[model samples]
Target chain A: MIMDDYKFLFKVVLVGNAGVGKTCLVRRFTQGLFPPGQGATIGVDFMIKTVDVGSEKVKLQIWDTAGQERFRSITQSYYRSAHALILVYDISCQPTFDCLPDWLREIEEYASSKVLRVLVGNKIDREDREIPTVVGEEFAERHNMYFLETSAKESDNVERLFMQIAEDLMKQARSRDLPRYDSNTTTIDGKTSTISDFSCCSK
Target chain B: MHFEIMDYELPTNFDVVVVGTGIIESIISAAASRIGKTVLHVDSNNFYGGLSSSFNLESFLKLNIEKRKSICMEHSSLNDTETFFPINNSDFTLDEVTHQWNITNKNKNYSDEENSAQEDIIAKEICAKKWLKDDLLKESRKFNIDLTPKVQYARGDFIELLISSNIARYSEYRSITRVLTWFNNTLEVVPCSRSDIFANNKISIIEKRILMKFFTSLDDNEDLIIKDYASKTYKCFLTDKKLSKNLIHYILYAISNSTDSTLCLEGIGNTKKFLKSLGRFGKTPFLYSMFGSGDLPQEFCRLSAVFGSVFALDQPIHGLILEENSFKSILIGKQKIKAKNFVLGLNLTPDFFLNKVKKKFISRGVFITNKSIMDSDNEPLTLLLYPAENDKNPCTVLELPWLSSCCPKDTYLVHISCNQINNPEDDLKHCVKNLFTLNEDFKAFKPLIFYSSYFSIPTNSDENVNLHDFNNLFICPGPDSELDFVTAVSKAKELFLKMYPDDEFLPRAPDPEEIKWDGDEEPSDIAQ
Candidate 1:
């Protein structure tokens, strides 16, 4: 899809279990500044970073949800109507990595079905890997999601992850025949790929 | 010279010293100065009035007016007669324009309840009545100082009115008479309605368009401004189409074009409330402050000067050498001195004298600018959530235009405040990006404007005092130096009056204090 078709800014949410280094990943990618010491994200922190993935000044309103369970309800609310979703898991923390299925089901139900989903296995920085990168990628492939391994602390493959998502979303946004799906309940399936039905912009 | 008060006699040596010649240290050095004070006053910076000093500021203001007039000439059609331009291109900062658009429609949707609050302008007459009965008046009278009605007189002194009104009440929510409209068959406050003007001619065509924009300003869409949407409420009387256009401009011009809804609402509500209080009172002056509010402190200083109140400059007190009974202090480049009484008129931030006493004081940087970064003839008052980049020393900036009648044309003042907080550059940048517009005007005219940058000193927060004195302190450090500057000069004047009841007080500008430490002790935290 041509990137010039979209105009208005959009806010996308990234949700996953704790120890995922979601904050570090975002900081490395958006600011290009390494975190001195990464800490667990406390509450909701959002960053509006302009990316050149589609050769346009597209501002991505990236909202990072806290991983703590008590914050689940708060994070759940942001899932509604999000243009895209990045459900991440820590490869080192098997418990967090295991929660991917629940996370996917939740996004499928709460977020738009057509929402562009990307599965990220974070914390690939350590040498002694807990969850194999192949397993994570296989899991993503099975679920029809584009998967990639990232290390926010070490600054590895972080840019490519967001750029790929942004590129994919721009393609969908550029399609004219695509029917505008409700914000929640949309998925990344190719069947609804017809670009004709999509209207110009709501504003 | 040094004065050391030791065992009723003076000591010849000192540990720390503070310098600079301004009223900010008046109370701080008064008692110390009284007893063979070794206090040093220096004016190398060539400024004596501290922050309130009108000496250099006056000519500085005139230069601003000249600059603005030139811009007016550049933008005018060449047919105008008045050399004094109302407002022009150079008069605004780039940040103000971008800020204006963003604030007016940050969200893109409109809310009726919030808009109605904007509509009730509270006419001048109505405001006087409210002021007469305000509880703050009693405190003012008890203090026995006459607070000349500042409302309706000079547009600048209105800040005092708002400050006082907030003290008396009206800061909390209150219901007011408003018109409602049907949207999707549900009753909503009519977005464009005003109570000040006659109902029939309340709005004009341009005002209607502006009102529509104001209504839609709250849309969450990325294209709109959120701060301006929240900053103003435009109420319209829809019976006539002609008035809508005029009313919209009127509201747009009147409000600082702030997109922050909370800030917009608070500003408008406080303004109307101030006027309402004035209307309640019978006294209303069209042009208040025969001299200016800054004149008030200057006059007090002048009176003190008539007495034996010797003033100095450039000599900043590095630190106060306080030990047991007497506080001996050293002045910059001078020997230590002792005083009988010591009152500090300097900003009371932790670093003020904390390190002198403790020996390890850290300096926090705060930035300030007066350029019109936000849209408004009088720039919208703005606060930065944070700065843009952090590798740069993280500092916070507080921007407010000094529009007092005493101030010159389109003179936007910028202030950056920081304390102990590091890597706040991103926060500061965010604040500038979101709240202010970095327009071409700012870029072209920035060099022409002198940038007076200073670090903020913390002072005691006068929260318990009546609203008039709420934030009042001899010197309170905030994110910048002006806060301390304002506090120190004002507080010095008060303390001076107490000591010398019949002296003429001459106002002065703020001065920086040099903090002293022995080997490497941290500065004490006096700013709490």
Candidate 2:
């Protein structure tokens, strides 16, 4: 396999309501800069980012699903093959926070049973936050998901969120004693894994 | 499990109100929304795809058992397979499907007659154990059976639409591993690509040269060969080429994929389509979805939502407010949602408009078989065209080996579709017997049919792309009984342009990372 050097190629999907900063969270984490006033994502778009996890090169194929009620089927289709599901909601919007249960329900239906999950509260830089950090943490705890708050606008916890997902995916793969995904042609949740040279982690 | 009831209210006004989430309506919804139109897409069923959906094994079985109110269905067995199994609608719900193996006792008998247990045929050569009904029921969720079985011509409109709309990223496709033709009472792989033709040992060296010459003639159509047989049938055209009977059969059934009565022009056109489609993605000229065909409609629906199109499933438009040959508003349950343009699936077309339109039914059968029709080392995604037998029409069979994730491991999901002739069973039974075994023929080299269902789907035959009052309301036809999406895409494109004459149709949507987040700087003219 050409991607033998990379320790893991994880397919992580981001799903939430519209205007919840799902795209912003992906942008800030992968690009280190968040563009404000981003428009709605049409369909599901993805990006490739390689991160360092304890000297292991982990490439993340992050799928950013459009956060609209109409796209539930499309987003749910991605869930079945995902290694990790990042359920994001805006911290400043009450409706987005309230919709976490729906998102969790989606994960229950479409996601693989062994998929690692993370709850993200995005747009935390906004001062007028409607949902508290405790509220998000409690909800995540109830669903048995790892929780974190991020400000894609300020780039706070954005990097940590993805790094933790990569690390956790590796940890989960190890604990389950599942075969390591080193094959360049291996499909994680049906999407082809990308093989690359020295990752950005080395840089 | 059901989704948490989403408290979504319909937008009071929308640029387009699309009902029925079939491929056609879904594409129109996405195309309209891609251009920034306020779109409201809804389906009567709880799921995304109304007719062209991929259901899990249980749901698919239940759909076959449970009678659909909106869509008409009829099936019956004839000739040798006279036994009929009727699904009592009350026995099963939409979510759960039930089936028990009736051959466990037969296993003991067959094995007792030979060496050991031999009821299950698929597991004999591959493994030591036999597959039981419980094994299939346990892994039912893995199956994604399409209601309308179809494949994408590698370069067909559907593929072009997916790539152009940037929705192709949402799904994955594997090229059909082989194109098989039913010949000499067995299936033989057709040499499609140039490499396959050159390497196929089945054709003699002399025959290979003749086939290659014919293929090269079909390459660009610059030769005067087709013009000479312009008015004759494609069969005549092939005979004029001095090709052998085997070569002629391969050309008619596999290459051109047209009927014997097909004109020389249309036959050559189909041959060109087939030839041009090869090697675009792989050795075969077809691409089957890695998941299932239903993923396509959902991708389009996703594109619509990315543009902020409001979507609601299980919401049926009960009435339409028509004023002077134009629709003003639609009544969904209790809410009145107004839209400038209304696009609806033919099955869901308001009876007022559909009063005069003729309806045609496409015969379909979904079977979960234990082995591939033509077993090979790697499970193949195969497309088999069984020529019309007796009174039945030509049947197109699609085999999604377990690797396609449309069925459980060690099981192949086969869908047989054709133009309805009286009953679906009669129309498809001959073809089913050709590829699979119905009775307990232990040694016959045919895929064992674990379970099967037959139904007929009603589609509009109207080639008059527009309805009489289509100025404001457009009716998109349900799936036609074709192996490709050329008809559906052209239909969707025509409807889209009628709704938005000035805007680019499904312009390429750029990746989100390609667009800068610079405030006040509008994203490029890429499909927003």
Candidate 3:
């Protein structure tokens, strides 16, 4: 596949409590179907989907936690290279929402300071919503993150949540503020040089 | 909210269960999981790499200071047919760990000195002021100090395995820019390629011509000449070639990466390997992981996890159940996990199992300095092989700058490793003194060590034939004293083949766009 087909590629990582519908939101947006009985994602690393932002095609690589969040044993390497982190919480469960601070502390410690963060309150279709919209909005404002409420079951606001991230990242890329995208070239003593003569697939 | 342990239940049965997350065990785990094995990889420590883990400055110092307490296991629960092997976790692998700070707590001002000392080029350029220990402590999180630091040949087995298995996507790397050696009590770059040899002005025209002729002779397929000296020492062969001392030193130490007593055949092979790997990545044939060598194991673990392996860290293994000399299951905090086979790190093996195997040791020293060992306009990743002198074993030194993300800006992380003849400090003190200074009244050229640590890691000798008596148990040794992961990769492949003879080892994993869901129509079109 030719990489230049996309105007920009962004790595968007989803992290939160185990059952906070993080996987459901990703499947709903990427596969266009909310998987039923998605028990602890297995054998699936990440999903890629292409979206349009202002007549440009942008590819999003969304990485799931793979149930590592169950024990809070997520690897630190997972957060280092992420361009954007989407922190999700279950609106119906107060405990998942209460764990937001814990996850934010991890982001502060592991993720880059300039990484784009978005606060997502998932599972909003349930009637017993313990966290109101205003509460999550306040938390996002306090943490300087973008806020959105999504319901994977009803397929509500999932597309817009991802589209907004892609657009914002594209704007950053156009302004030359986003991290340089996976170029093998390195600058040494004011000279830009390509370090590798062979690509990744070459022997 | 305070962190609480959740009731996450793991499956009781697995096709394979691996107990340490070192490079070998991790590679085996990834290989097993890649070929559709239900693998559960665990480590007693909270980190991904067991003995190979990297730590920040604070954690690294804390580990050196604290003594670990061993956990007790209860054997009363085992039945008559079951035998239990308790894992000893208390014995810390690192010995004689010594860490100290040379710089004081106060930061010095260099503004006044920078204007007056124009002729003192080295000191003025490097900023004459020393950084306070408090400053390093404040930026402690930026440091990724590795207990075991290694580099990979661009065309070596490890890089080939990574590329073939497609696990290289998880991490990044920077090439080693220069290769240096200690000759005449000074540091000098070893020219490996044609361009380097031509650009070097230190060697005479006649010496360069002789070196070029010797290298070109090696490039030709001369199997008869190589075989004639197979049983002889490499030094004898170099002497027979009538090469100068400077040329022999460069070939024996830096290019061939061998000791004086290395077999002629092995030395020639190493030289061929080194020459073949050049220009594949950069000026040198080596590539270091972006963060540290410690990041390598975690990348394999990530690949294992991606292929459906269950990963658990900070979880203690209470005991292993053996039935009629075959492994059956393991106990972890009232949970029993059964598996068809078990792969464990050498450190995790029971004392009874390892009674017959001899243990070896590697001396290591880690230091944080204010400047690079060899000054340059741009920060470069350097590899130095200090050959044996005065009854000392050859030392492998890697100096990493902040651009590699192993340390903070304007600081370098220096790692010295060698085979243990004595304690770490005694084994490495000579080389450290040559490269750095611990005193406040240090030379302007030598880098000052703000912090230094010396320790020894116990490794298992290759005499592990006794461990094969058990039909289903495999023990993996820790990192050896090699500069690459060639041995570790081959060992992992060997163990993997023994376990699954029919399955391919670490087949290339498809990229994200290549994977198709069950009911996907044509691949998603972007222009919809």
Candidate 4:
């Protein structure tokens, strides 16, 4: 809970086809504050959540986007700077489940290299889940994505998702600090961005 | 092998038969079984995985590791100083192999030189041009798509509209899908106005107006520019303004490239339909898969199995058997099973199904792997690699963190789809060979072959061809031209009605007689 430790900012973008709950999930996570009822997210909304992962105190900047087909040109820009992405699909809906690859592809394009993405099947609480859990895990596993089934309404695994992202980022930072690779890192775009400056621990 | 689960002799005849052993077929059979009816599931191939399955685990894992390493490079570069982003050691470290597990010293020099050449070629051929006015005009006529040429400091253009406009109010995933739809011609993009939206003070006045003017005129009509600049293909358009090459490439990569732009407008359309069909969402509008894409489907199967849904393997339905007013049972390996109801989750022809549907619709290309290629203690999850063609190739590639279920260490799988638009046999061969030459990481791993095929739905109907008129039959052909998505899903629904009773509702599926299979001559009334 220390303010200094909370300085570490990790931006996470939620992306998928239209009506995949990209917005609802974000609002559920950010505004719901871990377990509550909320409506759809408008256009683009950013929320800050402070979470303690073991000893590391991480501040998560969550960007909830609109999944409509007409808005790709407008919302695509936000994808570039994200440190991680949560690709969500409705389990009750097969097409949404089918479209997960495309959503993951966007994360690959716009997000930073260090982006840690988790494939999430939202709405697992429903009785007639159209998409089976096995298929979903296979999709994520095939693409090397960390996979999980979660219900934003149930607030199931909501906390675990963020904690995992924070852990991933911390591990990435440490790995970059390893001996063989140079201390100074330059981005693929040639800009000299530094993650070490924003480095903060959970404690 | 466990013999405790004895095989009950399956029925010899079925009312309807479905082909393909992929996820879609599994769902169809499971759904049929859940409704208290007997169903037969079959695959033409000896094994499963028609675009969705991981037959060869080694390549899958290798691809993932390479993807992770690429992401690691991106992470390190994003954090590094100018010029150096530590390339080695992260997430899963290289014990003896590079991030891609390229252990052979012979390939290292070739890989390095090849990568550099590819980069240069990509930059020169793909990145040499700025967005011209005419370049923004052309798009897929069928899909109603369009794009704006990227010009440097061209403020107020599509990019500005994207950043400034508050589109989230319209829908949960409006902006991203909107942009992608526009590019893919799946949805019509009503260019949101960008004039007042770009009035940021941080940007200088000139830059601001450039951005502003560009944004405001995006919706205006323009000419198409298909030109070759520095040997790279340039599809530019005019919007009453001009921009730089760098800006244009960024826009294209962000919207059209492979990695980030995998799903286009068509995908959005199907997804939108699915969400709407679910009715309303309350406090719990959104749901996520517990274990990944594979887990959710598996859960559905688990639930369906509990409900007595049977999934038959090694059974591929080649053709349907009709008997008078009702459809007879399907033939699977000289065995026939009879059912009170039947639902087909297959294409009209197996080969056509494989070429058009399996290769084009269901499959995706990716780099996957297991066990970190990087030498490190606590492995990083994702990696971004620069493919030789990253600059010029419209498709973007990345290595994601390894998934244990798909590939346990030292094992991996990657899916390669032949261009359905090409000649079938040639396309498949080229697809396999090109996969190896396309990326350096794939070169190290030997590809153990696997096969799966799917077909597209039919269009243009003929008389006397009712696939669902029979008492004991129904078919759910994935996505097709003749029938709508609602009709396809409800084909199963109507079949379910045979078992459950509510006031008999209208048939939701397209009339079977209306379905038109390609290459088949129209059945005349006399024939009927």
User: Taking the tens digit of each residue's C-alpha lDDT, what string does model 3 give over B42-103?
Assistant: 87787778667788888788876665657777777789999998875754567468888888
Q: What is the DockQ of each candidate?
A: 0.01, 0.16, 0.29, 0.03
Cα lDDT tens digits, model 1, B63-105, are: 2233221211232322233222111122111111011111121
TM-score of each: 0.27, 0.82, 0.92, 0.34
- Native contacts retained per candidate? 0.00, 0.13, 0.20, 0.00
Q: Rank all candidate structures by their DockQ, best first, as comma-separated numbers.
A: 3, 2, 4, 1
By DockQ, is 1 or 4 better?
4
lDDT scores for all predictions?
Answer: 0.37, 0.72, 0.82, 0.37
Clash count (model 4, backbone only): 150
What digit string (tens of lDDT, one per residue) describes model 4 on residues A59-102?
Answer: 88786552222223112335544678888788887877776666
Clashing pairs in 2: A81-A189
**Candidate 3 or 1, higher DockQ:** 3
- Stretches of candidate 3 exceeding 4 Å from the true structure: A1-3, A36-42, A174-176, A179-203, B1-5, B65-67, B109-125, B128-130, B219-222, B356-358, B441-443, B520-528
Query: Which should have the higher TM-score, number 2 or number 4?
Result: 2
CAPRI grade of model 4: incorrect
Candidate 2 runs further than 4 Å off: A1-9, A16-50, A54-61, A70-75, A88-105, A120-144, A149-157, A170-203, B1-6, B64-129, B219-227, B355-358, B439-443, B464-466, B520-528
Report how far off residue A78 is in candidate 2 (Å).
3.6
lDDT of each residue in B177-278, candidate 4, tens digit only: 111111221111211123221433334466555644543333233222112122222223311135443223322332222223333333223222222212
Task: Give i-RMS (Å) per prediction.
Answer: 26.5, 12.0, 7.6, 25.3
